[model samples]
Target: MLPAPLSEPQIRTGTAAAAPAAAAKVAPDAAATAPAAKTSAAPAKAPPAKAPAAAPAAAATSAAAASDAQPGLRPTTRRQWALAGILVALAVIGLTTIVVGLARWIAGLEPIAAFIAQYPGTYELPEGAPIGLPAWLNWSHFFNLLLIALIIRSGLQVRGERKPPAYFTSKRTGQKVSITVWLHTSLDVLWIVNGLVFVVLLFATGQWMRIVPTSWEVFPHAISAGLQYATLNWPLEDGWVNYNSLQQLAYFVTVFIAAPLAIVTGARMSGWWPKGADRLNRAYPIEWARAVHFPTMLYFSAFIIVHVLLVFTTGALRNLNHMFAAKPDDDWLGFLFFAGAMLVVAAAMVAARPALLSPIASRFGTVSAR
Candidate 1:
């Protein structure tokens, strides 16, 4: 009746109809008004529509810059780390040579032995302390070594990751995480499990007496043992029956103290930890976890190095026999067991690749390529 109501497309086309008229009105002053024309017409053409869109883009850029500005962990460069290792190795060799020379030349090696013998640093066993390495202990030792090696490998990979090689997304909640992190956390769980088993067996079998300190004399004994070690006049090799004070203390710290500290700190930094628990996060911040976890790893690394060296250099056959064969007698059987254990360890290393892990990761969550 009044004119059919314009369709949606017609209304849109009507806006263009007014443009020619508007342009005609400004045509006479086109030369002088050109600049003004552009300024006036730009809003109609694009500005209002584009301005709102630009705000979000600008905000996103600012957010990214702010995130980049935040403080992050800085890892030592590989070259620097390698150089430090070389220096440490040289220092160990140099110190050992000098100490041995002084022990031999100054007062003869016998005096050094006498000094070690005179020190009252030996741990006196109570009634019926467990003696000799048990089969459970031998197996547990190998398992612990394997788990620790894998944990460290994955931990270093997680620490140095600049960009993840793959990602894991939760099937239920669509949460995403890096694959390296998955491996690291998985290894942590395994290590903890193995440790718990070791602890239970240790107590059940009365082997706690071997590692746990029973007397204050352990301190002086540890010092004496340490000095004897430094002078290349080590205490008697009797690990099958008993450990020296230094060994006892080291095992005590590793089992009772350091391990627990590592577990707590590691859990705090992991995905298993509950998120947005303000009080808990405040009490145990990520910074604390980061600070403790890394140094603990270094301590384990150093301990392993020195422990292995002493095992080999002090009495390889006896040490190997005790750990691998669970026997006091020296023979090639222990070495054969060691070789088999190493092959298992090697197979584990080979299977830890991203390609292999990605499929396994998919069972827990949706795995994606980075």
Candidate 2:
């Protein structure tokens, strides 16, 4: 009976109390979520800022490292290089002609009389001592020797021009083909020996870099050389412009490219290449290597013709004098020594006629140049 007295009013009050408890639970949840959102948002922003800053710093460090590894490197001593170059040229003038003269004298199939006739008998050629003598009497002896080297070098450079020495086919093949090849290559060794003297003199004399072109060569490099016209002719360009800018480029390229190729190919033909075929093959494919090598010789032979023609057309005898003579004034004497010795080598060439000198000339007519 007492409990019943509580009835409607008591029931309402109890429900209201339950509502307040639910509201309290909801309030706590909202407060907890607010702090989490604030903290998480702040950490996210911090990470982005820090990431951007660190990225640039890392990028800068990497860039600096790259520059050091590139080939944009500076030279060691420019003045020394200039001096060395000049001395080499001087040495070439003094040494090349003399060797060619002596080789010619011994070869003996020369057209000239006094040149080859001077030495008709064989005088056991001293091994290391100057290979040819008498006609190679003066300092010009050295020059003539150098000329033979250049000729051999030039001869070796023609494209598909001559067959490679078959000495390495086997011992038997070597006996048949190698003796001459060995003899010919021996000249290169001899030439290199003499070249050492100049290598020393380059530093000793101090005249190397002037002969080499400078950095301004870049301007010429950018220009379209094909546009340049040739009015006069070779050796004597259009006028004061002896070698056109284009011609200069060609000359420089020859000095740098063709000559270097000849050297590499020659080295390949020598013993060094067989052991290191991988390196040589990079420049040319295996099948095409010999094809490319021999053809280059022919190509260089064409260059010689162009060069000789240019010299003669431009100032022939004078240029020859400058190249062969000891003193500029001494070209005449130098020419005699060179030409005379060449006659003897020419005789030897005719007798040997390795077919390398002129396969076509033999069929068409008898003609050979030492």
Candidate 3:
């Protein structure tokens, strides 16, 4: 379930390790008071040396406490039960890690390692399977990644936003919308366009053959490949030629199923759909769209995470060159291009901050905090 948006003030104040700073600031006062109190209670100089030695220890303890108080935004949640559940799960994982470490120390981890190494299955390519990934496919892959990531970011903003930081309005009709929603819808439109182009190019260049399964044997092969991956005995890296069955199946589902569903569901939820269409809305419930949309985002997120991990781990240089530099060879050019692309993404993220975005959003339409 989606958590409610945290307040702007809470987000800001919670960002710094304010607690530790406060403690450090108060400690000097306490030290001074202790010296004065001792002087009043007893006699003489009140052992000034004791205060100096204790000061160092107090400083050390405060610094240690500051380090323990991790420096980052502390998320504020209204749902204490849900927060408690997350904490409990984290504790369980920590305990499990300790248990595993102790067990390994007492008895060799060979048995545990052997169990993890068990992977079963065979991978086979159907006849006529030496097709290569084309240049257009590589370019489209990068573009699709960029657009989809932006869309997901904006979509989350729209969903959790209680008060829009900005707004967009139609010049012709004088209709207005929160800028968050406008950005989400606009990215969806762009994603749809990009997807359409990808689809056309895939079929035009006959690259669809690589992703679409041709035989029933593909299923068994996919199962085998999945098992291999689960057991950490991953399949061979040969994306320059045909993909393994599991990879093909995953691509097919993502391209043919998930993308289309995201577009359709987003469209239905957007303002472009005719309002007051009671019959149409009832026939295809908006609730169904709502239910499917978030999970689809999650699926895309998972796919991207695993895809990048494999791309790097399997063969970083070759994979980077293949996707970025459009060359199959392992070379520095691809790594350079990949680094540049990451910089661009980082810049976009920084530019997308509320303060930076609100003014641009105002240019298209009226903008207000609420």
Candidate 4:
């Protein structure tokens, strides 16, 4: 089940940490008060030393209060409870959707074939589809495209103009392998497989409308989108633009650059390239995957440069909310959920990207410092 999206503010550790900071602030004030108390006792000269004793007592009391209340971090509000209920309902619906969708796909029927008994000539069809995909799988590619676009856009919003240097590498040569290269490549593979299935189905069905850019004014669309991206002039003479030129371009690049790299690298990894399988079978497996994989890092870096600029340039939260949420909020809560999703995406990227690239580069000692 898709987890209930967190609110815009709840995942905010930066703001949440302020509570402890405030508690810390209270301690200084108590310490300051102790010094003033000594001044007051100076006139009498009797209670001067006793004033110092109050500081430690106050500190201990403050520490005890903090310790007791630490258990109550993030006290739930009425709004949170309501949101939780909605999340549960949504999860049920999502689970149902999955069951229903899988039933249709696996049983090779339109819907609910798994739930109901089949009559004679009910057509026991092939599993999935002929072109390495099941029927109606094109929708997933579309979703993947949209999600990848949003991820890139949100990533751009977070880090733009300047790139984060490669996370890990060889210390001897100051060499660093880019994490972006690996991330974009993996997602590209998944996206491409999703897309390849769709493309195959499209060809098999002769549905060229989806693949062929049929609009006569496509050039104008590209131009206008370019202007919006370059000049930040949104409200770009619109008729419900599903994707702008910038969107199209990035998607196009992912398809062309990152996606191809995955296929090539995968070929190298699996030893599928230069198909003389029997003679040169001794060659290192997946080694060929490494040769073309590094360039993908550069591609990802370019994508990031443009991606982050648009996030803040457009409303970051608003842009992100549309990507992650099933229901649109158009409010702060929507943005928060978007943030939660992106944080997950970012964490996943950070963890996985390093794994994919680091081993490959280190194996060859071909990595360069970023």
Q: What lDDT score belongs to each candidate, Candidate 1 first?
A: 0.84, 0.47, 0.75, 0.51
| Distance from true location, Cα of 248 in model 4, Å | 2.4
- Cα RMSD of predicted structure 3: 16.4
Clashing pairs in 1: 121-221
Error of 1 at 122 (Å): 2.4
**Which candidate gets the maximum lDDT versus the true structure?**
1
Q: Could you say which candidate leads in TM-score?
A: 1
Q: What is the lDDT of residue 98 in candidate 1?
A: 89
RMSD of each: 12.4, 27.1, 16.4, 23.4
Which 10-residue window in model 3 sums to the lowest lDDT? 115-124
Question: Of models 2 and 3, which has the larger lDDT?
Answer: 3
Query: TM-score for each prediction?
Result: 0.73, 0.39, 0.66, 0.35
Candidate 4 regions exceeding 4 Å error are 1-212, 232-241, 256-258, 269-292, 327-329, 346-370
The regions of model 2 sitting more than 4 angstroms off are 1-177, 191-211, 217-229, 233-251, 271-285, 328-338, 351-370
Predicted candidate 3 versus true structure: per-residue lDDT over 1-370, tens digit per residue: 9988879646754664486698789977876868666646643363344544675787799888886796544465679678889999999989867765665453335654453234223244556554666677677777777778788888888888887776677554466888778777767877888888999988787778778887676776676566456545576658777677788889999999998888888888888877889999999899999999899999999999989998899989998887877778987887888888778776775677667767676666666655
Worst 10 residues of 1 by lDDT: 42-51
Q: Which of candidates 1 and 2 reaches a greater lDDT?
A: 1
**Tens-digit lDDT track for model 4 on 1-370?**
8988777545664465676699788966776768666646634344345645775897799888997889667588999899999999999989867765654355455342322222211121223322222225424533554446544543343334256445444344444434443334335556667768766666676443322334544444554444333323352321111344345446556755686675666556431245557555465454555666555645766766676676456665554444444333356764675456557656555554444566754663444446
